[model samples]
Target: MTYQNYSLKQLQQIDAAHYLHPFTDHKELRDIGSRMITRAEGPFIYDSEGTELLDGMAGLWCVNVGYGRTELAEAAYEQMKELPYYNSFFKCSTPTPVLLSKKLAELAPKNINQVFYGSSGSESNDTALRLVRHYWAIEGKPEKNRIISRKMAYHGSTVAGTSLGGMDGMHQQLGGAVPNIVHVMMPYAYELALPGESDHDFGLRAAKSVEDAILEAGAENVAAFIGEPIMGAGGVKIPPASYWPEVQRICRKYDVLLMLDEVITGYGRTGEWFAAQTFGIEADTITTAKALTSGYQPLSALLVGDRIAATLVDKGGEFYHGYTYSGHPVACAVALKNLEIIEREGLVERVKTDTGPYFAQMLKRISGHGLVGEVRSVGLMGAIEIVKDKATKERFSPVGSAAVAIRDHAIANGMMMRATGDSMILSPPLIWTRATIDMAGDRILKALDLAERDLRNA
Candidate 1:
């Protein structure tokens, strides 16, 4: 009776009058209207107008198991009916979160054996910042509280998350960031690699920046070095293969804790349970959310390593930080069922063996396009860089305009995607088949052709 009773126009009118969206321009949005997504199933979403588009961004880089999972819904319903809401505080506990935490610990890296719950990636990152600092303080190094992040990294949007991240726009609007969180260069070989530099060499150089930051901070002051394993919101900037191991080695050398922000890359997104496993990274903390329950529920788990967990337990002081919904029973029930669904369907195995490789091969269809500067992909996530000059990899003036045009054209052609800077990003659901890949590629090629014509005309 909700959307059924309200007309699309009426909903849009009400939305414009009352709603506020994140990372949106309100004035510009008021000029237009919100595109109401009425329903979704498999890998497609239907708008209020009944136009269906293949979802290529996986509902903001979550929804790993895709949409319309009845098992997850039923799990939530059963949990709610049995135990609607309860706080994991005051010496109380819940069975669902307790069981979910054990499942997560089994899935996480061996050293990361404990779980801390929150409601979103932002909250988990906040917890991560607090946890690492707390760990150092417990170990009697309160001054070792500095965090090293990468430029263009997307941690989350909370004040602590924003400060831990290194986006220029977010920082400008942030007014001020948390202190001692230094930013280093990202290991993006496409732009950062020098002429005649091998990918392996470029990776080492990028990893060296962490060492430099540690040395500058005297190692005694730096607490942890945080980064997304695949840099998802940073245009899926996949680093060179040699980057992570070397960063891990440097962190070990400097005793700087490694924090992996896998909010977008966790829960089989990168063809593994976690991208830390994908790259053999031994991070002290892994911040995960988004696809944890395939977007069926809001939940985040900060996987803490043994070293930190043991110290905190031995210190025996209350952490003095936790959310009211830290371990909500309903969300935990949904997540357990969601993980079961992922495992039962062998979705991760499919991505690792079949779909992921096919996606890499299929993306070649647009690799040679006139407007495409370079194409890159890992697993199901991909990026197509739009450029004015192919030889020089020079982008068009008014940055992001061409990619935005391509994105719009792609959506109009029934292929949903996102544009970040001058690159078109695609992180489709894990359940996509070869046929879905072909369909998405065809629509994107059409979009590229249309955008090329418009750009050349201008």
Candidate 2:
């Protein structure tokens, strides 16, 4: 119960020497040391020194019900006491996972009824890739293994997830990536739109790229198209209104399966149970994690559509892919409780009707800031573009410097935000009320104002 035997500085030293953080530059982290987040509560996190911050990223876009929920903690405790650890293998079964699967089926689109579990979103995506490929092979079309993803689109960091993604820097390190995966232009109208293209037209053109990829690969060679409803880590890039429907039409035209990566947007973050429902699209597989347990436990459930499930069952063979912690009992228990909390508190409906709109309106009030080129949001996820010249939408000399500056200032002013490239992104907890939004707006304005002075002077 006592972890403070080492001082804060000592803890930092130990961390630098031993802990290798994900997606971190170790040398830089060693030099700066990590900011020790010691505790959290509803919509706020506190550092080791007890400085409170409005949690803007929702603990990496999870923690939807907010932090410090005793019910989730109690659920984990009870499940562990009952059935601590049991592998969902060898025809073994667990009550929590089975019940959780039923609940997920109810929440998911009508066609999606089955669930496959993993500990993280990355693992879920890997399972999805293998399973889809397996589906075609069972259907007697082994050559239909190619996948279509978008440039700057983030799936996950696992080998298959990365290969299926289109981040250039990630690919530079990813030697001998999973072959047959192709990337197309994302539906990001701010940059990819033509000189004077309408948002709807740009969306159509973006969807066309996927069709072109399918055509180039000859449809028969393509397996599925994977995408986030609204791009998350790649700067909360919300596609145009016309994008998903057009993309779905194209995918159906070619008979290509649709895979939705809802790792960030799942579990009511998009004001719906799934972003697919929010976007009015149906996916063959929905890769979900994150908010399932509100970060209280690590769990992911790949919602499998009936069509895919039917094929796997009718074809009759072991899928030959899964994780040791698949359908983990404790995680499933926590997730069931987490979902119950969201439903009982009406968090999803609140996001859809109240706070989501209020948050968007409040964001607009700060859009007049000189550093802001544009502000956009969907549900609780949003982004603020940091531009050197608002009229031209030009970024600072160094790509991420301005956004990082603003991020640092935001943190200093009691708000936690992430700087992705030239934009500051926010995915706050669903529990945030109008007061929380107003408080966040104040901190954001302060951060922008402070960063603007520093950027101009430099």
Candidate 3:
């Protein structure tokens, strides 16, 4: 029952027997045994085996303040001792919620003043779905209920969130996607662009697809379009310059509400408070989690622009929506303190001018390797696509196995990275420095080398 009572082997045995992990191939994990993380501090996690691993993915793209922040812990402790369980429902609210909301309004895009709290990114996204549809319904436009998302864009794992997301694998297992949710082409320049096409032209063409989908579905039937600014879990895809601007224009032309899903790209991940600013898109509502509390506590929020909030309020009361733990006190307190630290430390500005560019430069070196087909980065988020034939951009067998191997190699080499298909991604903590990146690059380069050698030998 105690930490010292179980040896590593015993812990692994117990985990294999009892633990059911998300987004994991259980059988494969059982074969390999879990990499039990025991402790962490400042962008590094120490395994049960006492191996120090650089967290290249920022603990599921959260943990913006990095690991082991006693400040956040103390804040949570203080709030829990005083008012941990109060809800924002039934004429009851807490100071944490009020303070966090003010901080979010200050941090979010202008005109976005309302904040609806949730416990996870998934729940926040689900809230967006309900809110958007409800907005349309309240306007007596029940027919306007379609939500458009781009292919490969990750929203979350909940039923409505997965439906809003465009991953076919996640959808296929869930009895097809939810109805009225349409998918448009994602602007992945490396994979989707044609040879000799200009980035601008490609961007415009891709943006037009959104309009096309709206037309095909009939603009009157579309409720909103949701997207991540950099498409985090979809491989840290940084859309070309013209993509988002045109998409925003199209959304306006079609009278579709834009919902920027900043679950990963929000906070300081993209060198900006929200990716919408990074891309210059004006959203009617925005979904955020992850870095809100830097993963120190469980929290998420749906930021409703003044426009949406006004309409919803005028339309009716008894919104008949929201989670029980929405706006939980402890979560809000931790998030407030976390944001304060991010501001006091100038983490967002640091990402914009320093660590982000340095990280990009470091990643670029890893490209041009025979196995590296592409390297794409924006702010502190990026991905290196592994390939079997770089000349033709041919991906490896089993589609994403090469990237998986590269990730495994990185893990074995004391760095943690994520692989989505053949794309190996790195989204280190926003506070990561050039020194930390250099250390990560060492592991990444080794992973690339090992992947290349293994593929060739196989």
Error of 1 at 326 (Å): 0.6
Candidate 2: segments with Cα more than 4 A from true spot = none
Q: Per-residue lDDT tens digits of candidate 1, residues 404-437?
A: 9999999999999999998899999999999999
Stretches of candidate 3 off by over 4 Å are: none
lDDT values of the candidates?
A: 0.93, 0.94, 0.89
Who is ahead in TM-score, 1 or 3?
Answer: 1
Extract clashing residue pairs from model 2: none
Tens-place lDDT digits, model 2, residues 178-251? 99999999888887788989999999999999999999989999999999999999999999999999999999
RMSD value for candidate 3 = 1.1
Q: How many backbone clashes does candidate 1 have?
A: 0
Cα RMSD to the true fold for all candidates: 0.8, 0.8, 1.1
Quote model 2's TM-score. 0.99
Model 1 lDDT-worst window of ten: 1-10
**Cα lDDT over the full model 2:** 0.94
- Pitting candidate 1 against candidate 2, the one with the higher lDDT is 2
TM-score of each: 0.99, 0.99, 0.98
